[model samples]
Target chain A: MFFNMQLTYEIAGGDFGKAGYASSEIKKVLKKLNLDLRIIKKIAVALYEAEVNIVAHAYRGSLTVEIDTVKISVKAQDEGPGIADIDQAMTEGFSTASAQVREMGFGAGMGLPNIKKNADELNISSEVGKGTELEIITYLK
Target chain B: MEAQTFHHALTILTDVCIGCTHCMQVCPTEALRVKNGKAELFDNRCVDCGECMRVCPVNAIIVEQDDFSEIFKYKYRVALVPSVFIGQFPRDIPTRGIYSALLEQGFTHVYEAEHSAELLRESINEYITEYEDKWPVISTFCPAVVRLIQVRFPSLLDHMMQLKPPLDLAAMSYKKHLIDKGHNSDDIGIFYVTPCAAKIAAVKSPVGDESSPINGVINLNFLFNKTYRTLKNNDREQCPIPEKEQLKDFEMTWTLTSGESTHVNRRSLAIDGIHNVIEFLEKLENGEVTNFKFLELRACDESCAGGILTVENRFLTRDRLHNRAKQYLKDVSEGKRLHNKSIDQYKPYLKQHINIKSIPARSMLKLDEDMGEAMKKMERVRNLMCFLPAIDCGACGAPSCQSLAEDIVQKRAAISGCVFIQQSMQMKNKLSNDHALRIMEKTWGENRFDKDCTKKGAKDES
Candidate 1:
């Protein structure tokens, strides 16, 4: 019989040091299920980059990592300054992180692209001066 | 699917945990949860990556490693050594001496993984040249980096270079060699000389589509002290590792972040240090810096030299890596092309079944046969998160404040799991009531609606 589990991690805005916690737990769950390593990795990357973006760019947010026998899905929502340009942001290498983020070794702008790369399907929506929402899914058949 | 059977290999003692949340912040899997008064561990989600054990300040976390007694169980043991071992010892320590030392450790045979590195380097170069149009290709060398991508950056899976890691390649080669020598395959066991807990976990429970070629992991730290003492009396240079000319240069290259770039002259990017690499990979994903053809990312600051389990200083280890790289340069010849046919033959062996679908069992854990229980659990989780010091210290058994809350809500953990929450609870019941209603109201809004509707509500809250 197929079973499902949903886990959540809160991404604190401006906390670069605490990034990727949710993604890490999601990875652990995927691994325990004996899913393919490559596929698990793809889910991990997408979830992590999105989580980091929430902390670096958003006011605050939470990442819900949902896993099941059929697929792995991550939904991240943040209450902060949202993306100004979804198209521009999706382009590889585009980022708005500040120097402090760079000092912490983030802000290189691979967050979105990496997310796109790992998930079989990705949908993101954001409003400037508002918050952002991301939905990512990776199949596990 | 039961969470109980999933062992908690990495752990923290409540009194010493300190609740810093560093483990939560750095954990790639989001496995930790901090609740009421202490940290609680979740079994079904832990990968045993050991990042928690490495980052804990009070030494509260401990990682599980196999004992030497495990060696006796294998009939024929093979050692899979990482290329970074070249930098750990004195310059005078020859490869033969190292091989002989491994023999003394109960390994029936020793194969230098450097050959796999050479094979991987050639394959990557050929692939990059053939697919030059592919923008910003990422390296598949580091297991942790790969896992980070899988769990945190799945969208970029296509960007990851399609190559087996050096250890996997080496294990495949070792198996082929064993078959050629007419050894019983079932009797032979491959053991990786792991440099980090992540590698140990990788060998035990790999993330991607396929199982690891190696049978088990032996931490270098667990063996280094004993092995070094054994080397004191053995012939320092008596064993042989074939000829330098026969060795593949790719293995030599796995020592540094620029290792891939050294082999292929492409517009590649390389970054060491976990946080820095994450940023660089993020930028690469964001299209902020799009000129590179390949990216070699490492989790450790000095590449493998800074692996969590290594004994040597990162700087010194890096210096030694440089010295070894230079020595290997003499062995490369333009005539030295990797046998493409041989590489293809090994493909079926390395390729394993992978499922890109979301993990079903995990998602099932989220559902409550009882909606009321689930809602109540969500309330408890939200309350726990609100009280979290927000330090993400990981002192709580869970990785973070939110993770702790989720665990509590899911009924995997309890309210008193976070020490800070208990401290605050003791200080004043008023603190608990401060935003209890508000937090619950927010949870109802965010959790009860779809993103479109939730977005509208979330905007107002923000």
Candidate 2:
């Protein structure tokens, strides 16, 4: 059987207190649906890292989650200074976060790598003066 | 699979409840709900933290404990005293004096829970040294914290220390001692003097152990008045106090928070209070907290001393216990002949491995029993929530606008239950009615209707 549902959440930048609220809510929804624990943990990790990236680096962002029987697809679009070099940004230990952001024990250049490790498919597109958008999908089967 | 046993030590008196949301809001597990002017507990979700009992203004919630009278049925009665119980009294009172008092109250033998804690600590140290892979081994001493992990963080089960609690160890040890002295096992009854309701529930229906070695649990608050009287009336001032080696400073400190982490000589952190514990566990789950060999998480603020059933202030008691521990160490340094045994001589009483199982979700937030139906309802609820005011005013008798939307999707409530929706609908009806009246007046003048009505009436009269 196949089913689908979508949820959207707005993420405000520098709101550290509510950074993971969206991911946690989605995790609760998935748990109630009786999904496997391993699958839920993987998706939660990837989604949380993506959500935190928006809060730490972007001015403001929005997350649209598409959930179906076989997979969960997440798209995060942010209105912030976009990445200049996609290949370099994808590399571990490379970051363009501010000093204040790094002081908060984030922006270790591990966010994208961690997300890629958990997600089955990841796509990134950015405009230097415009904004950045990321799409992540993890299979539930 | 065998059916799991459910035990709840909390009871609510409905008549005294004011339908206040204090308990509902403070519950860490969201196990409580106010329905129809009364508080109801979702038994499977409650961790028996007793936070509701502490927050209730009218004392409507009560902890259920085994009666002391039940101990009389056995030929011999053993009292397993948690170290926190000693902190309830004044510092001037000798530790041996309390043991003598318990014996005076008809206990065949009195055993300190700290002794068992010391044994468990040794075993854990050895276990950690051997299994270095499990760096962050969470302590399993606090029953409430253990249950919280079982319910909320099932993925972290492998990190929990696989050992029985100190009270269970003490009960098993005393039982063996009596049996060795030619006493029948059936004739002896072991009762733990507990500081919290969680321990009572833990003993009755334990999550890890196959069955609890302890027979019954008695609340310390219930025994305080009687023990206080016994301590005052006993006149043994002339008798020489028995000299016994007290537990090490580290062992005695187990009654309070951060004691285990500091004593174990490892990289560790201790978190206390249910809210703080929950927060820390979330961080750990998110991979934010690392590099610690152990994590001591207690549900109560100041560990067992801060339990709801405890009478004295946790800080003052902690100070008194620290002073007693210092005195104990001083006596040991002076070469006094105090009866103390080596750690190697003591064997584990747990005997069998304790298996902790994850609790299945109750799915209270799910809209239906079936996953597909629940997903459909969730979509509808989300759409309905967008139209709500989102003020969370509670005027509709639900806690929040989101909850009202959920209720509507569940068919337990109607959208009109919202005051704003009802007002808008009434306004629309009034405006439409006025519009219909205007159209009638425009099509037919008011005087024409009056003349037609008069002519029809005259014809009927003729």
Top lDDT hit: 2
lDDT of 1 by residue, A1-141 (tens): 445567788778888666756666555445444555467556666777787778778888999977665677889999988888988888887777678887797667777878888788889988878899999988866
Measured by TM-score, the strongest candidate is 2
Report iRMS values in order: 10.1, 2.6
How much does candidate 1 score in TM-score?
0.59
lDDT of 1 by residue, B66-145 (tens): 77667667787887777666567777886667676777778877765656555566577777887665557777677667
How would you encode candidate 2's per-residue C-alpha lDDT over B1-462 as one tens digit per residue?
Answer: 222123488788776665666787677876665555566676887899999889997778877878888888788888788778888899888788887777777776677677766777777787677667667988888989988887777656668887777777767766777787799999999988988989888898887567888888888887766788888986765532333535666677786898788767788898899999988877676665669989899999999989988888988878877887788788779966377543223364343432244333333444576667778878888789878899875545455777778778878666765666656766878435444433333322333234433232465532
Pick out the ten consecutive residues of candidate 2 chain B with the lowest summed lDDT. Answer: B440-449
TM-score of each: 0.59, 0.83
Would you list the C-alpha lDDT of every candidate in the order shown? 0.64, 0.76
TM-score of chain A of 2: 0.89
